[model samples]
Target: MTTSLKLKDLSKKEMLLAPGHRMCQGCGAAIVVKMVLLAIDKPVVACSPTGCLEVTTCISDYTAWKIPWIHSAFENAAATMAGVETMYRALKKRGKISQDISFVVFAGDGGTYDIGLQSLSGAMERGHDMLYICYDNGAYMNTGTQRSGATPFGASTTTSPAGSSVPGKMQHRKDITRIMAAHNIPYVAQASPSHHLDLMRKIQKAMSISGPKFINILSPCHRGWRSKSDDAIALSRLAVNTCYWPLFEMDNGKTQLTHTPKEKLPLKDFLRPQGRFAHLFRPENEWIIEQSQTQIDADWNAMIGAGAGASGVIEE
Candidate 1:
């Protein structure tokens, strides 16, 4: 059963991720971190790989996290968190630790979709009791806006710049959520910061469930995406409304759609706000938008089919 939380239920929650950090304004990653931290009531040990969330939150001689936090390198957050969880199990078995703790890893697309996949896959395969989240901003935003495995097709980035000679990023973004689901983990979900209740409910659900859990969140980057800082949340909503970033979850290999748009918006509505896809509006590049729209529709339809075939309905 999916538990529902009212605004009053969360009013008294502790602020685990403190403010006054240097994360950019309207940063989706920042919003996701804070919300994820606040979603739980149990003690949590948080881990973050080297990226915007890390460098901006933890600086020399200070920190923004109120809970016990560890800063890992770009490729080791999953491994680090797994080790910690294992140690906790051992200690509890020995009667040295009595308190329950949730182990969580917060890594970016570069850390997760690219460098950290090995450790991540291993952790899930091992069936560790933890929740791993990837705040995907679609690029290696911390490293000069370079193209990453999560970068969108035809989007301009530092390494995949659009020009007359070539189109931006010759490939589509990798489907990490589907890849995680393939691991046969207990829980796998795709969420956005714009939908707070949905995201929170998923987190609460993960907290109750045992075994490995994963949440892939669409974290918009203003600098990398070349969008207005204040537009991050709205852009996130548009991404969901267009079905570009579908909200779904897979439980025990069953698929469920969390939020479906009543009238799915056009792909352009989601892409037009971000400068990364600006060149696609050119006469010569209009075909790219059409191609993207076609692909989005196909993917959405396939997801719906999967949801119907194997239901992940809350067992309330």
Candidate 2:
């Protein structure tokens, strides 16, 4: 039998996002943004770079945002947000904008892992008091599903289309969470819409912390992944279970695994459902599936070591 729960139980008692936004149906990014907003108890100052979320929320003059928001350039979201927060700090000292505001920056994989990597690294290194969220939909969905650095292996995007000679994206996703952790930021975590409570908890904790915090959210794009809108959350769950995306957190300078699936699913179970990787099952394309499974196994082992703190890493 199926059970039902109220939205209130699944989310916080706050409403920052209202109706009339243009996000695609079952867009994971929207749910992520809502969770972030709900976790913030103070006035919020959010900056979004050019991406799907930005375009959907801010059309000509119509804005779906209730918080103080800004739309910055496509590649400088972190730099711009850090500057805004620095100015806010300066302004507060001069009795300008109040000091009760929380700062947050929303970036897509194209903006964070590809174009904005340097800027993002700089902000985290400088220890800015802000939350930078990378809504990784695996490709540049807003720009027509082009491959970005964060695109997973074998996913067929516009730029990396499946064809006679070429398969899809050539590279595995960048290890963004580890890159953030390397900066020695106070907090860094991976989250997804499949685990609402865990996502909300991490956001609240990150907000309470006092340095730069990064949250990498697995945002499933229907158009990019070529999947039905309803499959977004299920795909997210499959990703975690298959070890394609492991949920974990780094606090101060230690790593800890947040969630481990009870029943590990096969890589094919995850790959077969998405049209982006449909070519992998085509007799000749089976090697891609084998490669994916091998990578998942290696990654799972790495995560186990990272979690056990056997490599001199402490548990966060």
Candidate 3:
């Protein structure tokens, strides 16, 4: 079911997520949605949880989505999609529907990694034929920049503020991707809008599979991350280059590193640009930076070791 697509060829396709929606300038979630919709040629029924994407795209009676879309509760996007997919299967078996369709659910890190984790886990375990995508912007950006389970250690947020007393969020981000992989799903991957082609390819590959696929995309938040509006993609690129968010996928049970950095940059290169991490740059907070670097190095080494034969960028 995977389509053979090239970036150059995608320009001619009609856009599914239209412009003039209320998404902020340079919103990474919007970009991820556009790319995902473009990669799908079949009829799509999308379910979105209460988040920035849902609020902006479906304001009042006006909707920006060209396809059939549903706005679910704050913590049940996956559950709602599972019900729809189950009904679709029943109807198909009864010969009531003839056309092909795809089911996809979109949720923020707050919904995916925390509140909706039970619902998502249940659906995946039941082997639902649907795609669950987490557009993780680190924190709950739609709700006044509150910290979520996916917020990385030392990142400032309303709930986890940085000051002389405390240094931002004290816990590491939950590895939701690995958690999803543990279900033995057909497909699981982490992607970012910084690498458009790689994301498109991953989406295509995920869609080709039959049951329960998950893709967690690292979407940069302008307001929450205290980054420049235009720095979304740049920050994402820096994330990958620094091994802070290495691109990789798990097919069935085999893990693969998709786009490894040729020369892995220092973690500071990725963190120093964002105001949220500005406090960590102080001389007094040098230990926080060193600690973060140690964690990143450990993660990168573990990923490289796990994906032993996976293809990625090789040094010259």
The most accurate candidate by lDDT is 3
Per TM-score, what order, best first? Answer: 3, 1, 2
Candidate 2: TM-score? 0.92
Q: List the residue pairs that clash in candidate 3.
A: none
Q: Model 3, poorest ten-residue lDDT window?
A: 307-316
Per-candidate RMSD vs. true structure? 2.6, 4.7, 1.7
Residue ranges of candidate 1 with Cα displaced over 4 Å: 1-4, 309-316
For every model shown, what is its TM-score relative to the native structure?
A: 0.95, 0.92, 0.97
Summing lDDT over every window of 10 consecutive residues in candidate 1, give the lowest-scoring window.
307-316
Best by TM-score: 3
Task: List model 3 lDDT by residue over 185-292, tens digit each.
Answer: 989999988888888888888888899999999999899999898999999999999989988999988888888787799999999989999999988887888998
TM-score of 3: 0.97
Query: Model 3, which residues run further than 4 Å from truth?
Result: 1-4, 312-316
User: What lDDT would each prediction earn against the true structure?
Assistant: 0.88, 0.84, 0.90
What is the lDDT, from 0 to 100, of the residue 274 in candidate 2?
90
Candidate 1 lDDT, 185-287, residue by residue in tens: 9999998888888888889988989999999999999899999989888999999899999888887888888777767899999999899999999999988
Instruction: Sort the candidates on lDDT, descending order.
Output: 3, 1, 2
Candidate 3: lDDT of 185?
Answer: 97
